[model samples]
Target: MDMRKMFGFLFGLMVSLWLGVSLALAQSGYPQPTATTLNDFAHLLNANDAAAITQLLTDLKNEHGIEGTVVILNSIHDYPTGDDTIEAFATHLFNTWGIGDKADHKGVLILLAAQDRKVRIELGTGYENQYNDEMQQIINEHMLPAFKQGDYGRGLYQGTRGVIATLTGIWPPDERPVQSGGGSNSPTPVTTASSSRERSDGRMGILIFGAFVVIVGYLILAHIFGWPVGNSRSDDDDDYHSWSSHSSSSRSSSSSSSSGSSFGGGRSSGGGASGSW
Candidate 1:
């Protein structure tokens, strides 16, 4: 073919591929979030439960500067692109929606695919790797029981509460108080010292493990070189300090939202845990 015809054909092929990809992505079965905190597309939560969960998440964001959202879908397999596992779907949706601050990366997504009997707690890059265990614990201790009993609303609410507790070190009221005119109710504020204790224990465990590794490494090096091992110091304190400093500095400021408010443009690198009931 002539150069002109060849170039034209190549351009046409590129355009066709681009259009096809765009169309496929557009029909990927991800629902647009209408509310900032909750998108109950599966109709798993009742009006009260939904409102309560929304209020809980809204308060969490405003007070603690952590952006969180919950999504409920009937089944991923119901759509052409929903055939993927819950983990992939949650990660894609979380990044696509930008659930938290782009700079802070403090976003969390609680995804429930009801028909599939699967759930995922997707955390942003801001969270530590160890939180995966904590997320799994939340699913196992708080969520799975309700799910097995077919109490989806309870399961989701409890799961959300567990998430909030884990992140904030405080649990809000279990239910939102009644409001006038059927508007969003404000739950009475409550606090507890238990979650804080739990977080401290987790941190202590990590520090101990780190120190143990450091000591073992020092012993091994000393033995190899036939050097004295009278004294050794660990910089675990510095490491822990740096981690806390980063977490505090990277928190994104929360802004008020309405029904039309969207996510905060944050991204996640698939840091979370998944479960099946």
Candidate 2:
């Protein structure tokens, strides 16, 4: 083929491919922010769950003065923001929606793609230091199990709680609460002598009362029934087994829905992790 014809054919092919990709993305149901204030655009959450999550986010902002949102997408196969990893898509979505405080950039986005079986915890520039490890732990430990079991609601709920706890220092990444009574680096101080003495007395009184009650009960039982008590181990085991079966059946029949909203114009430099189940 002549150079002119060949160039024209190549350009046509590129345009056709681009158009095809565009069409696919259009059909992929890429989520659009229905309302800036109303989180859960994808409608992954049911009405009640969505309301609860929105309240939690609002409280987080009110208490800590930080903005955080959760975004759940049906799939990311033809994500509108470009065919990218969940991490990249999350970052783009976070910035596009502008999630956190405009000046401090203190926004956090927890993005979950149900069909893709992926999750991402994308943090704004302001939260990178505080949230990085905690976010990962939340995803790996709390969210993954629920996602694997198709419990998206539980996953999002636990993940959001983890994020909140981490930021507020209520739950450190180590899964331990910060000891309240000490200097920044010092160990929590031992209890005072008077407090310890009171606790000891309290324990002793409880133990003596418990022993007396047990002795009285045993004497009454022995007098009425005349010796050793009958063992109820077999009956207890049967009841436990029945309860376990009922619980297992109930768990298997459960389902969950989730919803989320757009961000507050916060930007990211690709600072988050991604995972799949």
Candidate 3:
């Protein structure tokens, strides 16, 4: 019994490890593109100075023929734009750069001057879940390698590279549908549908597996403790013997003993006759 439980524990551990590795490989681990260097990317758009942001986006659509939009925000309800304001910048960018005619597709943010402003890039709903922290880090760390030496176009290249990789793997690549060829006609926004489903399935699987493990563990503990779920008295009664020495046997025994007592007399007449003679 003890050995059985140990085996179960080991099996569960192996399954969990496999699941983790599979998830990592599926989401992250995108090969970094070598065709264009981040520096070269920066120069393509020439987005070091204030006007470079606009040029970088134009280059993405015209040169690379990428299909997407860039979002930017000026201000919102006097919300202080600071280093901690990632959401504010993202929101502003979404509205300003998200829907535009400048790129004929999507525009990656140049972040021309946002020292006090928080900066973020959202990949239409399509890439929101696909573009995870790994991809985001590539942009933050390498795209803008050095604030002094880096250009905004480099950041766009790195960030958009992640997006393009994801789209190529999952959706159509080599052809920018949403950017041209009647793909941009629709204004109805897209949602992150696939990720939501995956998240829901993941949570449910955890709950189910957790519940199963707990139940099995409890049963194992009870077996070792000798706990019973029902009464044991019925089993004991089935093995009992019947008492057959009833009062009928006692009545016959008493009659035999009484008759013997009355018949047990000595003959005294013979002794009296001998004395008279």
Task: Using TM-score as the measure, name the better of candidate 1 and candidate 3.
Answer: 1
lDDT of 1 by residue, 1-277 (tens): 4785666556655655664565444444455566879887655566888888898898988999999998877666554445479998888888777899888898899998876788999999888464898899999988888777666667778899999888888977788444344323122111234324334544564565456445444443433333455444355455445444543443332123233657788988999899998
Best by TM-score: 1
Answer with 2 or 3, whichever has the higher lDDT. Answer: 2
Span of 10 residues, lowest total lDDT, candidate 3: 268-277
Residues 26-87 of candidate 2 have per-residue lDDT tens digits of: 33323545443334433455554566566667778887887887776656653434656887
**2 or 3, which is superior by TM-score?**
2
Residue 138, candidate 2: how far off, in angstroms?
0.5
Backbone clashes (count) for model 2: 21
Query: Candidates' lDDT values, in order?
Result: 0.71, 0.61, 0.35
Please give the lDDT score for candidate 1: 0.71
Question: Pairing residues by index, what is the TM-score of model 2?
Answer: 0.54
Best by lDDT: 1
Per-candidate TM vs. native?
A: 0.61, 0.54, 0.29
C-alpha RMSD by candidate, in order = 22.2, 27.2, 41.1
Model 1 weakest lDDT span, ten residues long: 183-192
